[model samples]
Target: MARSTAMKAAGLILALLIFTFFSLAASSSNNQIQILNAERRIDLSSHIVKVFLTLKVENVGTSPASEIFLAFPPSQADQLALVKAQAAIGKKKKKSYVHLDVNPTQLPDAPNGTKYFSISLLNPLSSGETATLEVLYILTHSLEPFPTEISQLESQLVYFRDSALILSPYHIKQQTTFIKTPSTKVESFTRVEPTKFAGRELKYGPYEDRPPYSFSPVIVHLENNSPFAVVEELLREVEISHWGNLQITEHYKLVHAGARHKGVFSRVDYQSRASVKGASSFKHLLASLPPRVHSVYYRDEIGNISSSHLRTDYRKSELEIEPRYPLFGGWKATFVIGYGLPLEDFLFESPDGKRYLNFSFGCPLAQTVVNKLTIKVVLPEGSKDPSAAVPYPVEQHLETKYSYLDVVGRTVLVLEKKNVVPEHITPFQVYYTFKPIFMLAEPLMLASVYFLFFMACVAYLQIDISIRK
Candidate 1:
C-alpha cells in the first residue's frame, strides 16, 4: 500500500513539472516575436467582410522561430470562412509573394478563448531576422442589419464591429486600419484618436507601442446594397458513365441573407421605383460552369423557369438564372440546375490502369456562400474501391444507389462540408477501378429481352388458336 501511494505522488509531481515546462516555453516563444509595422484594410463594399493584413515581423529571440500566430476574438472566429497567408520575398519592386500554410491551433493559456491560426514560414527566421507577410481572411454573417426589418423604399444600413488595433499574440510597434464602404453615405462610426473619414473610406490608428492581445473596439455604420445571397443547402450530383457523357445536377435551397423585408410587397412599386427601392433585393444569379457544357437546364417544382439564359464558348460557360419572383430578405427559393459534359473531358485512366473522374467541387454560383454543401459522385457499376481526393477536409462516406439496368447498384461517394465560400470551388478527383466488360451489361440485357420476346411470338404463331382449328 505504501509503495503504491508513493508511486502515485511521484507521477503527480512529474505531470506538474511537464505542464509548467510547456507553459513557460509557450510564453517565451510568444514573447520573442514582435511586429515592426502592420497595415490592415477592411473592405465592406459587399455584404461579405474581407480583411487584408500586411505584417512586418521581426524575431528578437535567440533561437530560430518557424511560425507566426494570428489572433481573433471568439465571436469573430465562428464567422470566419477563410484564412490565407503569403510571404513576400526579394526587395521592393522585385518582391513576390509565396503562399504559406496557415492552420488553426489552440493555446492552453489563451485569454477569453482567443483563437489562433499559425502561419508556417518557408525558412526559419534566425535572431534579428525580419519577414513580410500578406494575409487575407473572409468572414460571412458578420454584418448586422441595424433595423433588422426594412420597408422596400428604405435603403440598407448595416453595423460592422471590429477592433481598430491589430489583434496579434506579439507586441506591435505600430499599426493602422482602413475601412472602405460601398457608398459615401456613412451614418456614424466610432472614432479612435487619429481617425479620418474621406469619401467612402474610414481610416483609424497609426497607434504606436501596443502590447500583445490589445484591442480597441470600433463600430461603423454604412450603406451597402450588394446582394447577400446564401445557399442554405446545396446538393450536387455528378454521375459518370463509361459510354460518352457525364452528367451533373445541383439542387439548391437559396436565401437572401440581408435585412428582412416588412410590409406588403407591391410588384408595381418595386418595378417602377427600382432605382431607389428594394436596393438590397436581387432577382438574378450567375453560375460559372466548365467549358463545352451541353444540355443545360434549370427548373423548379413549377417546372422549367424561362427567365434564364446560357452562354457557352470554348473557354467557359455562364448561366444566368432568375427566380420566379425577386428574392427579398428572409425569402427563399429552391431549384435544380443540371448539365452534361463529354466523357473525354473529365474521365482519364492512369498508367496504372486506374480510372478517375476529375471534377469541380463547391457551389458554382458567383459570390455566394454555402451553409452546407453535399457532393455525391456516382461511379459506374462494378466499381471497386472508390476514393475521393479533396483539397480540404470533408466528411466522406460511401452509399449504394440503384439506377437503370443496375444489378449490384452503383457506388456513390458522398462528401459533405459546411461554411463554404466561392473560393472552395476547386477540382476534386474520384478514383476507382472498373472493367470494360461491365460496360456491356445494359446492352446485353436489352438484347436478351428482345430475343426472348421474339421466340415467344414465333411459338404462339406456330401453335395457332385451338378454337379456330
Candidate 2:
C-alpha cells in the first residue's frame, strides 16, 4: 500500500507540472523570426556533409535584430567549420560580404541538447526588414558505416539520418532540402507521405509553415564502392631559393579508411574476384599540383617505386602513382614524392620592401583526408622575423634548420595543423625580408677559396727546388 501511494504521488506531481507549463505558455507573448525560404544542399560523394544553407530571415519582433542563431546537435559541433557567410540585398540580390562574429552557447534545457552559434550582425536590421544569408560548412564523418565490416567481395553500405521536417527555434515559412547521393545506387530511403524520391536525389517538402521546434526524422541507405582513403600523417617540406626555384617534398603515411576485412587478405582470391566483378579496392591515386612541375620523384622508406607517371601540359598537371602494395581495407603504406616549381609562381614582393613566399598545403590528391600535417618552410640563411598568414588555425614554431652551405642556420617555419580535408587545401604565405646581398655571398666565398687554393699550389711548387738543394 505504501509503494502504490508513492507511485500515485509521483504521477500527481507530473500532472501538476504539465498544467503549470500550459498555463504559463498560454500567457506568454514570445517574439518570432520568420524564415521566408531555406535550401540545404548535401554532398554525399564525400565522407562529410558539405552543407550550404541559404536562408531569408525576417524579424517579426517589436525591436531591431542585432544577431541570429544557428543550432546544431551536440554530436555534430566539434568538426564543423563555418566556411563562409554573405548578406544578400534587394531584388537584384547583390551581396555585400560581412565578417561574422561567432559566439557559441550551450543551453542546459535545449531540446536535443542543441548548441547554438549566435552570429552577430555588423549592422542591426530594423523590425520588418528582410535579409538573406548564405552559409557553408562541412559536417565530417556524417555518414555511418552500416554492417561495420564487410567481406572482401561485398560492396559497402552507409547510412545518413536527418530530418524530413525542418526544425527551428522560430517559425518557418517554407523550406526544402535537396540531398545528392555519392553513387547512383541508392537502395532504400524513408518512405514518408510528404517526400518525393527520384534516382540519386531526395527532395523533402514545400509544406506550410510549422510551429516552433517541430521535426520529423528520415534515413537513407546507399551503396558506395569508392575507397575511403585517409592519411595518418603528411609531412610537407618547402625550401625557398632566391636563384630560381622552389622545391617541395611530401611524405605520406596512408591508410584505407573503409570497412575492415573479416579475414586475412588473399591476393589470389582478390585477383579472381577482380576478373569477375571489378576490384573494389584502391588501385591508384591521382595527385594534382600547380602546372610546370618538374624533376618529380616517388619513393618510400625502402626504395623508389617505379609505378609513377607525370603528365604536364598547358592546361593542367597531374602525377599518378600506385602504392607498392594494393591498398585494401585496414592496410597501410607510406611513400614520399617531391617536385619543383618556379619560385616566381608562388613568391611575392611588397612595396614596403618585404618578400613573401606563398605555397599550398595540397598534396597530389587534395581530396584525400589527412589526420595531421606538419609543414616546414626553410627560408634563406639570413632571413629574419618569420611570420605566417594562414587560412586556417595552426600552431607554429621557429626552429634553426640548416641545409647545404648554410653557415647560420636557415629560419624554418614549422606549422602544425590537424583534421585536414580536401576543402582546406588552400595556400598560406610566409613573409620575411630576403637581402639581395645574401644571394651572392655563397658564390663569392667559393671564388675566394679557389683563389687561395691556386696560390698555395704555386707556392708549394716554387719552394720544392730550394728544399732539394
Candidate 3:
C-alpha cells in the first residue's frame, strides 16, 4: 500500500509539471513581445554576424514577466556558434553586462531547433510597465555553400537566410534589418515587398507590427573569391630575463575556409593559376617584427622550414613565410615562429624603483583572423610583486614554471583573448620588482661553489695521506 501511494504521488507531480509547461506555452503565444529594431551586419571579410536587437517588452497579462526566451532553428544549430552576447536597458549603447543562460530547459516534445536561451531584466516587469532592451550577439558560420561544390578556379556563391521577422516570445511592434554583401556580385535574394537595395546594402522592412507567431523569410546569395583564413588557435609566449634578453614566440593552427577544391591539389595547375593577379589560394603570412631583429626563427611541427624570408632595414621588419603546402579550402596548417631582442629596448625603471616591461606581439602575416589567442609571459625567477595590464578583453592569471638551477619557479602571466584581428596586437605592461640581493645572488652562488671545489682539491693533494697509508 505504501509503494502504491508513492507511485501515485510521483505520477501526480509529473502531471502537474506537464500541465504547467503547456499552460505557459499557451500564454506566451497569446501575448507576444515586440521588437523595435533589428539591425544585422554581415562581414564576409571575417565571416561573422553582428546583430543588434532593440526590444520593448512588457507584462500585459497579470503575473510579473521575469524573463524572455529565444531559440535558433534546428537546422542552423550545428553550423553556428555564439561568440558574444550582452544586453542593456533601452537605447543603452554602452552595453550592460547580462549573462545569457543557453538551452535552459529540455523538452522532448518540442520542435527540432529548440535551442532556447533566456535573458533577465534587472527588475521584473509588472503589468502595464514596459522595458526596452538592447541586445547584441555574434554568430559564426552565417553563410553556407549554395551549390555545395565548386571547381578550384571558379568563384563560389554562398546563401544566407534569416527570419522575415525577428523571433520573440511576444508580438513585435516594428523591425528592420539592413544587410551588406561582401561584393557587388549578388546573384539572387528574397524580394519582400518594400525592400530596397542601395549599392551592396540590402534593406528588409519597417513592417507593421506582427501578431504572435507570424512569419517572413529573407534569403540572399552572393559571389566570393577571397581567400578565407580561419585560425583555430594562436599561442604567443614571452620570456623575460633581466640578464639581457626578451624572447617572443607564436604558434598558429589555421584552416582555409573558402570554396572547396573539387579535386586533389595540383602543383602545375596551382603554380600557373597562382601567378594571376587575384588568386583564391592562400600562399603566405606576413609578420611584423621590430627593426633589426636578426634572431627570428620559423618552423612547423617538423624540425625546420626553409621557405621563410626576412626583410629588414626598413621602418619595420617583415617576415614572409610560405607554408609547405599551398592552403586550399578545408586544408589545415600549423607552425611556430619566434624572435629575440634586447631587454633594455622594452624595460624601464620607474621613480618608485619598480621595474616594468612593455611588451607586444602579433601575427607575422597579413589578412589573418584569429579565433582564439593566449599569451604567456615568463618573468625571471625570484622576481616579486607582480601585476599586469593587458589591452584587450581577456582573462588574466598567473602560473609557475621552473628552469635550470632555479630555487623557485618563475612567475608567468597568462592572458587569453578571443576573436583577435590583426589590429589587436597591442602592448601590455607588466610590473615587478627585483631586490639587490636577488640580482647578485646567482653569480655569488656560482663563484662560491667553484672556489670550494678548488680548495677541496688542493687540500686533498697537500695532505698526501695516501703516500704514508
TM per candidate comes to: 0.97, 0.82, 0.65
Any runs in candidate 2 off by more than 4 Å, and if so which?
1-32, 89-113, 118-123, 165-169, 184-193, 206-218, 264-279, 451-469
lDDT string, candidate 3, 1-469, tens digits: 9999999999999999998998776566336444444444545544555555656565666767666666556655543444334445444486455644333444333454555556665577677777655555555556676676666666668887876566554576676777777778889889887788788888878777776455576788887556677788988888888788888888889898766667655677777767442255678878888765768888898868999999887468889988998876678998898998788888898889988888774444566666777888898888888888775457889999887767788999888876665555678788898876776767887898899999999999898666665
lDDT for 366 in candidate 2 is: 48
Better of 2 and 3 by TM-score: 2
Tens-place lDDT per residue, model 2, 1-469, is 9999999999999999987786554223124467888787777776656887888888787677777767676666666643556676545656456657666654333587776666677788677888888777677556777867877777778888877665566678788888888767787888656787677788887767877667777889987666677888999999998988999989999987776656566778767765323344686899987888888999998898999888899766888899987776678999999989999888999787889987876445745777788999988888987899997778999998877777787999999987777777778889998788898878987898899999999999887665555
> Considering TM-score, which of the candidate structures 1 and 2 is the better prediction for this target?
1
Quick one: ranking by TM-score, best first?
1, 2, 3
Worst 10-residue lDDT window for candidate 2 reads: 23-32
By lDDT, the best candidate is 1
lDDT, residue 381, candidate 2: 83
lDDT of 2 at 287: 90
Q: Write the per-residue lDDT of candidate 1 for residues 1-469, one digit (tens) a residue.
A: 9999999999999999988888888788899999999999999988778899999999999999999999999889999988999999999899998999999887667899899999999999999999999999999999999889998888888999999998888999999999999999999999899999999899998999999999999999888789999999999999998888999999999999989999988899989976577788999999999999999999999999989999999999999999999988899999999999999999999788899999998899998999999999999999999988998779999999999889999999999999999877889999899999999899999999999999999999998678764
Q: How far is candidate 2 from the true structure (C-alpha RMSD, Å)?
A: 8.6
- Which window of ten consecutive residues has the lowest lDDT sum in model 1? 460-469
The per-prediction tally of clashing pairs is: 0, 2, 11
